[model samples]
Target: MEIEMIIACDDGEVKKLGYGKTVISCLSYREVWPEKIKIGIVHTDGLDATSILSYLIKVLGNNKKSLVMFDSITIAGFNVISLPGIEKLTGFPSIVIYNYKPSIKNLLNALRPHFIDSKIRELAINQIKSYEKIESKKGILYIVNRGVNKEDAIEIINSYQFYSRIPEPLRLSHIITSQISKIINPYAN
Candidate 1:
């Protein structure tokens, strides 16, 4: 069976600069460690869905068959990206994987205070509501997907798990983002 290309995204710790921001890293893979890596910055607790999507589009230019994976929908401190929006824009299946099920109530509580606009908060809540729980060899994973069935998503995820529950592309992206963030913001914890 031929392995489809996988592009996975993950963010590092937020740096406490003006309004707070973090490094977003994405790595592409196909039965290998990584074929390409891209990085971007996004504001913490900001409405950065468009920014995240734009970054992914750039990374996945002309690559229609690749699967896009996210460590979480909410990255860079509540900067939520829409899986459906990504799928529509990039013409690729998208998935958000979580080691544990996300708490909608807690997410709502956190967003309510930060985002005054009801539409923005509602969008985030709706995205969280779409997650479906699935069991893998590693453990349970909560996921939300677009342009792909749950079984295919699970199979793709399982194929990428070698070191941990997190997919290899996402795991590598996380490590790259963390090290880059430390270099960029030495004082950030």
Candidate 2:
């Protein structure tokens, strides 16, 4: 059984930290849908990948590895984190989906002031492997994938997306994170 952990982040009054929600689902060919299994929350400061890793470990408990999916590579933390960092640390192949291709130039421009070497960051960006773009009757999406084959990625997206252009897990995660952040931070609207 293949399991996917879909992630989405919601920001609150806390400017530095973001509330990230992960929706875990078991994928099966028979159902052609993601079976909801678990949901987890991670509190992260901008640019802190360690917090994310720790929260995931706490949530996952026994399951050390699963296919990790994120609405974007940089969440919770402005563009302060790296996709390779998450994939390498967790040992889970990560798949990042977007409505448009990520902007390398803009990202580097944003990071230049903070980091000593923009070139190294550029190299990391270049190494990201993009599989075929997913174009369905519902919508068009760009994907950056690591550790999973192209066929499986396509299948995962197809199985999870039912009601909208966004995959069900992503949509669910978004809703969960939004509601959770509001409760966690009463000041946030």
Candidate 3:
């Protein structure tokens, strides 16, 4: 069997940048270590999809099958990324995982202040509502996926949640980005 590659994208915030630094990780899913980790900066709680995606594509190259996982569709704040666009662009199976049951309307109200652009706000709202539910040890996980069906995505999620309720790629991403953010800016939240 071929080893599956996972490109897990996460962002870290610094007070200096309006957004933060996005860490795009090239990881072997089962092995649980990052093969390539690249950092790309984004506006503090702002638009990062384009820059982060473009950078990862260049680093990862073409015609390679991989899985893309996001800690959330809206990173930072209302800064949203598209799973379908990424799946189409990179030909990778993509999954968006959220541990809590998300309320899009409530999120929209909270995030409305951050986004001046209506389009960005709308996209963020849409992304927030795009997930289907997957029950896990922690709680209900809301997920949206492309290049993989609902049944397969569930199986994939279950298979990955070995050590904990948190998936390996996402758990590793949280660890790495948090550390990187602190190192990048100790004073930052």
Candidate 4:
């Protein structure tokens, strides 16, 4: 069976870590959607969470079977803290990208919040669970690396739904977005 997954990624570099989304998208391309898949992007002039969510829902349609990924890029903290409403909006299985350097297990150990990442993960899982509001299924959230190489790619994939890692639809989206970004922002690195 083909698995459908949605990933919300970080969209800025540094704090605007949108590249995190690209990394997830790239992995999706190489590992998941090897051929054809529908992909879309949603961004905003400001961090208007409600607007972003609205735009995504409108474009993706209300089919729960469709995976809706968020490019958590640098904006996840904002969502976790303020956009509780968005959690309710995502009626499909959703994944957000977190691009920290350490493994979630390691971060849980060294971080001052003790199990902060774990807590957030649990929170996401639970919130999505509540949002799904259906039996026999629930939305999922994943934390993965911005891998540097093919081996790292494997490690990153081990963290998510697939056996080898990375889903195909998102990977294609990354390549398409990168090329488009260059054309759209020629000077951007």
Name the candidate that leads on lDDT: 1
Winning model by TM-score: 1
lDDT of 4 by residue, 1-189 (tens): 133433333332212235322111222222344433333333322234444554454344344333334443223232331234444565433343322222434423443363434454444333322221111111232432221232333333343434222333343444565554444343322
* C-alpha lDDT values of all predictions: 0.75, 0.53, 0.65, 0.35
Candidate 1 per-residue lDDT over residues 1-189, each given as its tens digit: 233688888877775644486777777776676877777778776677556755665565455468888877787877778776676667677788888888888777777776767467468557878889998778788988877888888888888888888878888888888888878775544
Q: Model 1, poorest ten-residue lDDT window?
A: 56-65
For candidate 2, the per-residue lDDT at 133 reads: 77
Q: What local lDDT score does residue 97 receive in model 1, on the 0 to 100 scale?
A: 86
Q: For candidate 3, lDDT tens digit of each residue in 1-189?
A: 232666677766434542354433333343555666666556655666655665575466444556777877776555677766676667677778878777887777777776678566577458666678887655578888867777777767776776776687778777777677667664333
The RMSD (Cα, Å) of candidate 2 is: 5.4
Model 2 is weakest, by summed lDDT over 10 consecutive residues, at: 21-30
Runs in model 1 lying further than 4 Å from the true structure: 1-3, 186-189
In order of appearance, the predictions have TM-scores of 0.88, 0.66, 0.81, 0.40
TM-score of 1: 0.88
By lDDT, highest first, what's the ranking?
1, 3, 2, 4
Residue pairs with backbone atoms closer than 3 Å in model 2 (clashes) = none
